[model samples]
Every structure is written in structure tokens, then in C-alpha cells.
Target: MSLSSFGFLIEEASRNVRRNGLMSAASITTVAVAMAVLGSAVFLLHRVQQFMDAQPRQFEIAAFVTMETSRSKAAQLKAKVQRIPGVYRVSLVPREAALRQMMDEDHKAGTRITDALVGANPLPDRLDVQLSDPKATRRVAAILRDKDKFPAIEHVRDDRETLDKLLATTRLIRNVGMAVALLLFLATAFVIQNTIRLTIFARRREIRVMQLVGASSGFIRMPLVIEGVFCGLAGSIIACGLVLLVIRQVSQFAGRLQTPFAFTMPAAMSPSVIVGLLLAAGAAMGWVSSTLSIRRYLRRV
Candidate 1:
């Protein structure tokens, strides 16, 4: 089509929207509410996943060295553990240092119990291991415990049960969020589709007259598609504005809290990105829903 034809179609779309002012307002408002709810759910789930991903960095495993193993041998074990695939860092704590730490802890608790046993420190030297990934905790712990692999090591300790529980909870939350989002998407599409159908129904006679006058289907469809796109774009702007406002307020509140649970939005969900996503989703939903609505109606006419 020529530039003039495209311009004319856009004008027609605007005119249609103006002519049905009440329905257009209702459609835009409905789309905005639906998209807002869906977008908020997505934003929340993404943040929850980020928080879960961060928990692994603090997880640590302890590998105790036998009393017979010299400090030099424990250093060698540290080197070996450091070479493991998921190992982030390894530090060998000497038996003397471990005993001193225990004594300090006892003293802090208002007791002198551990002071007398200073010379008879029975605490074994241990390697404190930090992991790059929490999921690898079990495998690394198993490797540390292998007698043949490191005979100097007496035993390994890790909180596998806690890690498993954390993973299970994350998966459950993600699955449930996805299911809810899908349902919201279907409902939003239905509303947009029906709204567009109402507009088309009001203009049925005009469409038939154009068809009889030898206007191509493309000519008849272009204006209606443009109408949907406009509505979608308008609705998206409103939804994005509301979501951004809530995000800003929540982020500020989280930052002021003096706790480990304080949350800031992840870098991936920047304001610019959020706006782009909502606008794109709204426009695509509008285009597809409107096209489907009109195609079915045209078949009978």
C-alpha cells in the first residue's frame, strides 16, 4: 500500500476509537488492569528467584583432618579441595586456632570452662569450604569424605537436607507462579478479543459495503488492526506507570530495612526494560486478539 493509504487507515482507526468513546475507554481500562496484574506477578517471581539464587553463596562445608595428619598435610588437602570443580574457596584452620576460637566463644558466654584445656586441645584441624553453587555441595562433600582420595581427612560435614528443602521450595513457587500467569494471560486475551469484536460488530455494515465495492480484505483489516494496536499501546502505558510506581515504593521501603532480607530490584528488571516489555506484550496481545476476532466475523459476512 502507498504511504497515503497507510495514513488514511490510521486516521480511520482514530476516528473509530473517537466514535465509540465509551467502549474504547472501557476496553483500554480493562486491558490496563489485566496487564498490570500479570506484570506485577512476573516482577515478583523474578525477584524471588534472585533471592533464592543468592542463598548458595553463604553455604559452607567443613572437612575435618585426622589427629595424625600434620598441618603441612592439611595444607595439601586444602589445595586438593580448592581444585574441585564447584569449590569457591578453601581455608585450613589449624587445631590450635580452632581451640582458641572455642575458648573465646566460651569466654563470651560467661564461662572459663575451655581455658584449662588449652594445652590438651583435642580439636582436629579442618578445612572450611565455600562453594560456587549450592547444588554441588553434596558431591563436593562426598569427594572430601573419600578415604582413597584424601586419606588424611577424617570426615566431612554439610547441611544437605537444608539445601534440598530450599531447592524444593524454589521450584514449587516458580511452578505455581507460572500456572497463575498463564491463566491471567488467557483471561486478558479473552477480554481484549471480545472488546475488539464489539467494535467490529458496530461497524459491520461499513465493512460489508467496502467488501461489495471491491475493497480487498487487507484494506478492510488494516484499520481494525491499527485500532487494536492503539488501544493496546494506551493500556500498556497506564499499566507500566502503575507497576513502576509500586516497584519504586517497595524498593525504597526494602532499602531502609536493617536486615538481610532487604531487597532491591534485580538489574535485569530496570525501569526501561519493564516499560519496553509491557508495551510489547500489550501491543502483541492487541494485534493477535483483534485479528482473530475480525477473521472469524469476516468469514460469515
Candidate 2:
């Protein structure tokens, strides 16, 4: 099509929106409301997944060295643990520091235990092993418990039960998130379908006149298609803004509500990528729903 034809199509689409003011507002508002609910759910899912993937919580392996193990032996063991397939790395905590920590705890408990053990630091050296994957902590801990392989290791300790519980909760969160997302998508689709149907009904005569003027089917359909896409885009933009606004407000209350189970409401995707995805989803939904609605009027056109 020529530039003038394209310009005319744009004008017609804009004119239709202005002429049917109530219908246009209703279409945009419905789409926006649906998108907003869906967008909020999407962000929440991302936050839950991030919490599952965060660090420190996954670092659960603790291996204590025997009293017979020398500092040099413990250092060598640290390097060997790092070479394990699933282990991230291990840090050696000297016995002296460990003793100090124990003493500090004793002091906090209103005890004079440190003075009694001044000549001998009875605490064993510690090797805190962090695994590449939290779920593999049990496997790694078992590997460390082999006395023949790691003679310096007296015992291996890990919060296996707690880690297991946390992982199970994460899985539950993921399953719930997926179910919520499906429901929200269906709701958005339903809203978009009705918006398109109502717009088509309001502009039935305009479509007929364009068809009578010997306009190509594509030409007559272009304006409504454009309108649908614009509506979707506008609704998504509003939805995204609302989602961000909600995040800001929630973050304020989040600070006080979460402790020991604290995690950030980080962006699910980069801002640009998220906006692009939302815009594309909105446009695609608008296009499909509008096409289906317009086909109802195509027989007469």
C-alpha cells in the first residue's frame, strides 16, 4: 500500500477510537485490568523462584577435622574437597578462631568457661564445604564421611532435613505459581476476546461502507487490526506501570515483615526484556482476538 493509504488507515483507526469513546475506554480498561492481574502473578512467581535459587541457604555442608589432624593436613583436605565434582569449594576455619567463637558464645551465656580452657583450645578445626547444588548436600556429606578416603575427617554434618524441607517448599511454590499463571492467562484472553467483539459491533456500519467503496478486504481490516494492537499495547504499558508501582509499595512493607526468611523482590527479567515481552504478548492477543471477532462481520463486508 502507498503512504497515503497507510496514513488513511491510521486516521480511520484513530477516528473509530474517538467516535466510540465509551467502547474504546471499556476495551482498554478491561484489557488493562486483566493484564495487571496476570503481570502481578508473573512477578510473584519470579520472586519465589529467586528465593529458591539464592545462596548461603544452599551452603549446608560442615565437616569437622579430628584432633589428630594437623593444620597442613586440613589445608590439603580443603583442596581435595574442592576437586569433588559437585562441590563448589571449601573454606578452612582454624581451630583458634573456632575456639574464640565458642568462648564468645559461652560469654554471651553468662559463663566464665573461657578462663577454664585457656591453656587448651579443645574445639576441632572446621571445613565448611559449599555445594554447587543444595539438593546434593546429602550426597556430598556421605562422600566426606568415608574415613579411609579422608582420614582427617572425624565426621560430616549437614542440615539435611532442613534443606530437604526447603526444597520441597520450593517445588510447591513452583507448582502453585504455574497453576495461577494459567488461570490469569485464560482470564486475560477472555477479556481481550470480549473487547474485540464489542469494538466490532460498534463499528459494523463503518466496516460495511468501507467494503462498499471497493476497498480491499485487507485495507478495510487494517484499521480494526491496528486498533486492537494499540489497545493491547496500551493495556500492557499500564499493567507494567501498575506492577512496578505495587512492587515499590510492597518493598516498603517487606522490610518489616520478613526476617530469617528474607529475600528480595528482584526483577523477574531485565526491565527492557520484560516490557518487550509484555508488549508482544498484548499485541499478539489483540491481533488474534480481533481477527476472530472481525471474521464474524467479514461475511457481510
Candidate 3:
């Protein structure tokens, strides 16, 4: 389209919005709220997936070593475990550290178990093996348990139940996120479409006159489409600002949490990417709703 035509459409679109102040505001608010809800759900799903990713470590294999095992021998043993097909990480859990952890737990429970065992530390040092895939946990465990497979590996232990629970929770989050997002997307489209219909209806007389003068459908509909797009874009911009504010507040509040967390919270999407998505959603809602609403109106004419 020529610059003059573009400018005319923009001017007309802006005038339509200003003329119907309340309806325009309502449409913008509705779109903003729907987008915000969907965006929040997506953000939460990302965080949930991060936790789900860390869950496999909880079901990792514990390979105990003989009391006579040396530091060099343990290092060699860890290196050997890393060479295994599915093993991605093999961390050494020294006996002293293990004892300290146990004692710390006991103290929290109001027990002085460490004092009773002060003369000798009988806890065994171990190697913790993390698998690239939790499904390989049993296979890796069985391999470690083979007869005389690294004599220092006294035993190999893994818990399948923990892995199962973690997997279930992740799946639940994914299903719920998708359902909520779809519902919100549809609601946003409806709000934009309804808003555009009202804008067009108010100009029905002008449209009939244009038709009588041999104006093409595109000539009459372009301005209405622009109005719908403006509403969508405005709502999307406001929604993005709100989402960013909410995320900042949430991050600050989370940082002040009194209870300790075992794992770090996963990083959020980059600011640029998030802003781009919000803008795209807004523009898409505007364009799609305007086109659909105009086509529906044109059919009746």
C-alpha cells in the first residue's frame, strides 16, 4: 500500500478507538488479562521443567567403597564410572562429609548421635552416579552391581519410586499449562473479534454509502482492520509491562524466602525474547481478529 493509504487507515483506526472510548478500553483490558494469564502459565511451566530436570539426581546410584580405598583409587574409580555408557556425572562423597551431613540432620531432630560415635567414624565413602537419562538408572545400577565389578564398589543403590513420582509431576504440569494457554488464547481472539465488530457496526452507514459509490470491500475494511490491530497492539504492550513487573516482584519475594532451597531456580527467558513474544502475540491477535471480523461483516453485505 502507498504511504498516503497507510496514513489514512491509521488515522481512521485511531479515530474509531477515540470515538468508542469505553468499548476500546474494555477490549484492551480483556486482551491484556488473557495474555498475562497465558504468559504466566508458560513461565511457571518453564520453572517446573527445570525442577523436573534436576529430579533424576535424587534417584541416582550410590556406589559405596571399601574402607581401605585411597583418594587416588577413588579418583580412578570415579573416572571408570564416567566412562560407562549412561553415566554423565560421578561425584565422590567422602566419609567425613557424609558423616557431617548425617550428624547435621540428627542435630536438627534434637539427637546427639555424633557424640556417641565420636571415637570412630564408621560411615563408608561412596560415589554418586548421575545418569543422562533416568530410564538408564536400573541398567547402570545393574552394571555397577556385577560381581567383582570394581571391588571398591561395595554396593550400588537406586530408587525407582522417586523417579516415577518426579516424572508424573512434570507430565501433570505440562498438560495443565497447555490447557490453560489454549483457553486464554481463544478468549483473547474472541475479545478482539467482538471489539472489532462493534467498531464496524457503528460505521455501518458509512460502509453502505461507500458500497453505493462503488468502493471495493478492501477499501472499506482496511480501516476497521487497522483499528482492531491497534487495540491488540496496545493491549499487548500493556500486558508485557505488567508481566515484567510481576516477574520482578516474584523474583525479589523468592529471594527473601526464609527456608532454604536445595537447587537453584532455573534462569528465565531473556528479556528480548519475552518482549518479542508478547508483541507478536498482540499483533497476531489484532490482525487475525480484525480480518475474521471484517470477513464476517462483508458476507452479510
Pairs of residues clashing in candidate 2: none
> lDDT tens string, model 3, 1-301?
7899888878877888999899999999998888887777777677678768776664578899888989789989999999999887999999999988878867976888788997589988889898888999888898898767787778777866666776797789888898999999999999999998888788888788878898777878888888888888888888888888777877787666543323456677876777788889888889999999888865434
Clashing pairs in 3: none
Superposition error at 140 for model 2 (Å): 2.5
Q: Compared with the true structure, what per-residue lDDT tens digits does model 2 show for residues 1-301?
A: 8999999999988987787777778778777877776776676667667767774444458899999988998999999998887788789999999888778767866889788976798789999887878767878888899888888899888877876677688779778878877887776666666666776777778777877988788997888888888788888888878877766665667655633322454445665666677778889988887787677645564
Candidates' TM-scores?
0.73, 0.77, 0.82
Evaluation by TM-score, superior candidate among 1 and 3 = 3
Pairwise TM-score winner, candidates 2 and 3: 3
CA RMSD per model (angstroms):
6.0, 4.8, 3.8
Clashes of each: 0, 0, 0
